[model samples]
Target: MPLPELSISDWQDAMAREKWTSADLVEGFLAQIAALDSAGPCLRSVIEINPDAMQIAEALDQERQAGAVRGPLHGIPVIIKDSIDTADRMLTTAGSLALVGNHASQDATCVRRLREAGAVILAKSNMSEWGYMRSTRPCSGWSSRGGQTRNPHVLDRSPLGSSSGSAAATAANLCVASVGAEVDGSIVRPASANGIVGMKPTVGLISRYGIIGVAEPQDTAGPMARCVEDIATMMNALVGADPKDPTTSRCNARPMVNYRKMLRPDALAGARLGVARECFSGHEGTKGVIETAIRALRDLGADIVDPVQASELPFFGPMELELFQYGVRANINRYLSTHPGAQVRDFDELIEFNNRHAADVMPYFGQEFFELAREKGHWDDERCLHIQSELRRLARDDGIDKALEKHRLDAIIAPTEGSPAFAIDTVVGDHILPFGCSTPPAVAGYPHISVPAGFVNDLPVGLSFFGAADEDAKLIGYAFAFEQAVQARRAPRFLATKS
Candidate 1:
């Protein structure tokens, strides 16, 4: 009953038979992680293995035997991005040395939901340093606490980030699924690079109570896994209202727990889909793959409109960065104030810590963004106050919302990232300019999901489907259908090992 290539639903169905149990799956995956992380390919995707993963899995199996099935996620083993708080044995460091010994005092709201749904938190995955804001020079997967997490497909290339290990671990089948949080390109970019499904749920859709700090306006935890079905299944557990953060409560219009049921094979059949011009302008290989994806949508009977133009405002670029910097200092400061045991107290203290431990903390890169952000005033400042409202208004109302209303479209399609992961460069920062698929949805705080479309020169590529706010299900449904129709996903071969 065990399928070595089992997905979330596939594994659940197989486990329904008495012959299959969570322990079997856990054992199989633990072996997989050991082989990949230690011996076979030597990936550092798993930052820390949960010592009690098997114990938790065995307990869940017993609960099921006692007629207490939790739901789709019951007994499913999933790794959490280092940024997500587990409130368990694993330290939630977000791949930073400063927080190495810190354990979350409480489970992040999203983590609690997964546990409530009976999913076993398997491990803590590696990530970009301080979720990629600390310094540009550090490699995407080379965190101070956990070294580089190589791409499962090709060891030398990137698996993308700041959710680097989440994408690699999920794509490599080290876990049944994993959760990845995004601030702009973190989830979608890595998903594209690793050939998995990366969903950036609408801002406030999932509670960020225990998640490590980032720019809240553009930050959200979503599913990063092998297929669209898995992403939807994980999302069902992750999305909800939380009292700790009023934003989740304010997202009254957010989708409730049934994302998987919304997947219709014909979801794209009559939908109006736009071809994002910006997403394809630069990279030839990526553009070709996206064009092919668009053609597939057209074959599915979608009306594909190319260059359905939307607003690109005067203050758009600077405003997004501005919001992120202001939000980072404010939110990280707030998180520190609440969680006092962490080594660093404020952004300034974090800077001091990095200076004190520069060899380990800033070995490869300096915190240019952090220094710049520290100079910016708090969210309450006049410039910060004026810009935050304007940024959200412009990104949401004048951007994605405007495009959808003007085109009368249900969704838009774009290359999830410009291309696949570039070679890891410790001295130089990320070369991520080609992302047409990320910006609007990321900036707007709307939902966007990327599914594996194909590969270019053996590296992964992705196609993104995004829509206006409260349309998480629509994007998921369309991406699922497209994935089904194409079946383009393939596990990374790393390299054909032949002497």
Candidate 2:
């Protein structure tokens, strides 16, 4: 039988009914990957397929037959970004060649949680080299190890960076769901561009141990799937305190609740949504799409606060760079020192390695960001500390919190990205249109969700709903309500070019 859309619930129902075994499901996905990922459209999304996947699936099927089912995710296939460590046959390269032969000593905290929940580590998705922080003008989804990950909707258009492969694979139904890491637009923008649901939970909600570092202050791992329910299911497995990552300790004070319970179609009836007008001033097509979404929200009984002015936080832009530069240098050095079998021991070594292998690593774009990061002073420098503190104050105290308080809003809404997918330009680099809603929440380490809003031309765009810190469940409910009302997500046709 042909596979359905394969949401978490659908997959579970099929498995419970014995319509397909875990092995069968794994084989189906693997076949699809072979035909579509790097063969048909040359998506180049999956960097490495898990060689032990079949064995794991067979074991899960045997366990299920003996009535030892683990949970909703038992035997489900999940694609994880290459930046996340798996400790198995797959290598965690962060889509760079420098870390090619190194194997992780253990699974990342999130990966371990997924395993405990009975998820099959299906494959490793490609990502922007070093999470798109290596160059001044980086190409979205272009990685040294895996090449370019193309958007399924239009093969020529970009699958926006960093988490590009995860979003693309999920949108194309190559897997039931995928895990992605974010340090700003990495999760939401790609999810939006690829027409899928992406959630960036509060920074501490998911542990970062074993994942390649981008910035400690803002980096997080979250779920990317075709629907909010799948995202919630993945979230259920990923949240917990890990001794390896101290940030998780913050979550212990407020333990995680099942996010699936919060998905109510009537969730918007009494919700108040504030529109961040700043994020809407993008392409006219994108603006119109978001305007239609606003109308849908209003029709769904939501109180709409149009043109909410929340983007004027002081030092919002500059301080983000300051924190990222300092944090990446310090955090990566710490991670590299402890990571097993890593060839490049520090930022300086990584730079030298890239320079030596410039033919492969710097074929299209140079590592200017890495060079600049190396020049940054220590994380505890007076200026760095001040910028970090001020950024938090402005983004949280004076930005999202202030807006919500003034309007008595449940969440803030904005266009997840500016345009759908720009044409891939390898020579000059990605022509990223000035459109995204990742900054305020990212800098504040708050929760953010992106849902498919509508299409612009033949490409997909997303509507973002973000809330104050630790409000992930509520945001999920709000986004689910919006998703149900809009019913905007559509399967990609894999068009050869934009219509």
Task: Give the best candidate by lDDT.
Answer: 2
Measured against the true structure, the TM-scores of the candidates, in listed sequence, are 0.95, 0.98
Off by over 4 Å in 1: 1-3, 136-138, 250-257, 310-316, 496-499
Candidate 2 lDDT score at position 240: 92
Q: How far is 333's C-alpha from truth in model 1 (Å)?
A: 1.7
Evaluate residue 184 in candidate 2 and report its C-alpha lDDT on the 0 to 100 scale: 84
Give lDDT tens digits, candidate 2, residues 104-184: 888999999999999999999999988988888899999889999999999999999699999999988899999999988
Q: What is the C-alpha lDDT of each candidate?
A: 0.82, 0.89
Best by TM-score: 2
Q: What would you estimate as the lDDT of candidate 2?
A: 0.89
**Which pairs clash (backbone N, Cα, C closer than 3 Å) in model 2?**
none
* Predicted structure 2, TM vs. truth: 0.98
As a whole number from 0 to 100, the lDDT of residue 178 in candidate 2 is 98
lDDT of 1 at 129: 74
